[model samples]
Target chain A: MENNNVEILLIEDNKNDAELAIRAFRKANLNNHLIHLKNGVEALEFLFGTGKFDVRDISKKPKVILLDLKMPKLNGLEVLAQIKANEQTKAIPVVVLTSSKEHPDIKRAYALGANSYIVKPVEFDDFSKVVTDLGFYWLLKNQPHV
Target chain B: MDNKEKTIELIIANKKLAFQNQEKEKRAHELVSANKELAFQKKEKDKRAAELLLANKELAYQNEQKDKRAAELVLANEELAYQNEQKDKRAAELILANEELAYQKELKKKRASELSNSNKEVDDLEKRVKERTEDLESFSYSVSHDLRTPLRAINGYAKMLEEDYGTVLDAEGLRFLGEVRSNANKMGVLIDDLLTFSRLGRKGITKSTVDMNMLLETVLSALNQSMTHNAEIKFSNLLLAVADYNLLQHVLTNLLLNAIKYSSKKEKPMIEIKSEQKNGEIIYSISDNGVGFDMQYGNKLFGVFQRLHDDEEFSGNGVGLAIVKRIIDKHDGNVWAVGKEGQGATFYFSLPDNDK
Candidate 1:
């Protein structure tokens, strides 16, 4: 809620998946500035500085967002549509994480301007690798619009 | 002179009177004859008049008969005219009836075409149902992801536990955790195999000329890369197959792996693969000299998750043969197996001889 910059905004409803991703990022030292929102509506409010996050600075946005497709209330695709359609948050790279590689919504996510896509594999090692790699890419490797 | 004259006169007179008397007598006889002739002529005239009257009466009778004939001819002409009109009406009805027959024939032709169109519609409906089936299969594929999510969490947590607290936990505790992780991994494999089998149903087979030798070589090389096997694989006279190459490759991989896996315990593991032309089909067989199964359980050979042997004896998910069966079924082929306990198992699959 204060004036600062966040790196990765992970919007995943599942707690265990979120905890595992956090542990993965923490192990890779990428969780210091990472923000975890439980659902899509909360994520939208956080991004736009509305609702509970109204007191937060709207200009200071995350470098990248890890969006999950299936969620309560406004789903990831809907959240993604709002992000990409808005000029304020559209430049922040949104990498969509899906539970399945063969998900039909992944295509729709991309079509709605998702920067990248990753399937959350069942194996811990694979899930860890995907999380850390995505953290590193968005935080270190990728050049932001700013 | 007087006396002579008188005497002469008297004699002449007397002679003249006698001649006149004789003439009168002759005249009287002639008169009688003439009168008889006149009477006979009158009788003849009367007979002629009666004949004339009779002929006149016959002529009148003939005239009356001619009049009756004329009236009958007029009546016959009217009847003929009425008959001609009736014939014309019948001719008109015949023409109308012929037109009706022609129209009926045209209607029949239209009905046949309509029937063919309806048949086409039925085909379209079948195609739509197939598409919907594929759609549902794809949906299940996505549903499989949701199933794996929780599975991933379970496996991930255990893995995290081992990674973070393995040094603190006892050896037995670590083994228990390992069991949990392995079973989760096994479930994951089952899910994947089920997906693969379901995906096979949705796959549209694109068949081409496939070199079985190359296919076998590819499969063999892939098998070599995966695990170290002691089995001797022998395949000879493998016929060139007309099939979906990738599918055939899948079929080969599953069966060959089965042969190697089952026969791994044998001192001399032998795997034989052969393809031959028989009964308008390209019959392919893979025989393994391994821990074979009983012939009684042969009915469940190609069933999904239908295992003949225990997992402890044979490490299999019971989907290889099922997958092989499905691939063969897609190719309009057959799959069967023959085996006896401790002897061996021979798995056979045949593809239709498309060239023939």
Candidate 2:
């Protein structure tokens, strides 16, 4: 994995979801610079350049962070709070992608400074379209803070 | 003196000088005897006078005792008369007190009856609200659990099939697959909207002084991001309202989105928002130059799943206006609309101005 140029960080715990999201990105040809972190702990470790990713460059921040709310350890809201709290990672666009739209954490996610929120559609095509569209919007259209 | 003269004449007839002397002696004796008699009579008179004086003293003492007894009787009579007057006054006071007590009892009876009637009304209202809430809760539960899970599976598996067998399938097959996926997606939206409607019924409103201008601006920015429309919305110096911030946001979003969607076909889609104070209520209106509905079906506009236009013309699940109606009703407000067939439409709602 080229850690220096990682553009999209997908923090998802479910194996099927990770695979589906990766496939969707690949279909849209946006998977080349994407990194899939299975849990929040590893996501934090990778972002901070600690633990197993200690040797990688820490300054290379992803253009967008696709976070899932429910996880086994250090759920998305906590991770989001940590991310937004740090000046180094505060500018990164964090999009909360979740299965349930009515999850009580949605408002909390927005309150915690998530840039955008999207409910993961059950249909594969719609999910794929959403991912592709978000990739295009954040990567191709939006101007990142320098 | 005449009796002595007669005795002397009888005695003097006997002898001249001697007889006359004896007669004189006899007359002298008789005079002495008469003097004695006179003295005894005087003594008796003196005793009678003493007895009369004792009788008079006894009568004076009796008169004194009678006068004393008569004074005591007069005092006793005066005391009895005073007690009778006091008793009459006390009886009159008791009569007035009894009348006042009876009046108070009558007032209490009337007040108790009114309270009982109000309690009955409150009990009936509570029962009706509870029944409707229970029905809404059960329906929401079923929609959330039974409906959504299967819809998820359907949509998920359909996508899997399309992904796994896309190369082998022809164009028509892909199109059919697309339809299935879209329909499933539509069903998901419908379920979501239904859940939102049901939740509004159960959710308690958290009130605050909401700045309508700021709230509308935020909603407009959000809508601008979600969809593209060419409607000129107008509002300035909007009034602040005390309401639930999030619920009011939902209300504004629905009305504004509807206005934009219905007026999308117009050459110049115009949406004007204005507010006025009327009869202790703040009335807010959103007017749009849209494809309006007939007044005949106006009563049915806010019903769930009641649509005025076909899906080809304007697409919606028709739960938006119902949610708006419910939110307004929760605020103790009223919602209504005025429109002609193809000219334009105006939606009006009033919230109680309780700040004053």
Could you report the DockQ of all the candidates, in the order they appear?
Answer: 0.45, 0.20
* Candidate 2: residue A28 Cα off by (Å): 9.7
- lDDT by residue (tens digit), candidate 2, A1-146: 69989999999887777777888898889999999998899999988888999988978889999998878779999999999999989999999987765566668898999999998776666777898999999999999986
What value does the lDDT take at residue B104 in candidate 1? 95
Model 1 residue B164 distance off true place after TM-score fit, in angstroms: 2.1
Q: Itemize residue pairs with steric clashes in candidate 1.
A: none
For model 1, how does the per-residue alpha-carbon lDDT over B265-324 read when each residue is reduced to its tens digit? 999999999988889999999999998899998999999999988898887798878888
Candidate 2's docking class is incorrect
Quality of model 2 by C-alpha lDDT: 0.88
In angstroms, give how far residue A63 of model 1 lies from its true place.
5.0
Residue B61 of model 2, lDDT score: 86
- Pairs with backbone N, CA or C atoms under 3 Å apart (clashes), candidate 2: none
TM-score between candidate 2 and the true structure:
0.55
Q: How well does candidate 2 score on lDDT at residue A134?
A: 98
Off-target runs (Cα >4 Å) in candidate 1 are A1-4, A54-64, A87-93, A136-146, B1-143, B208-228, B232-242, B277-280
TM-score of chain B of each: 0.64, 0.64
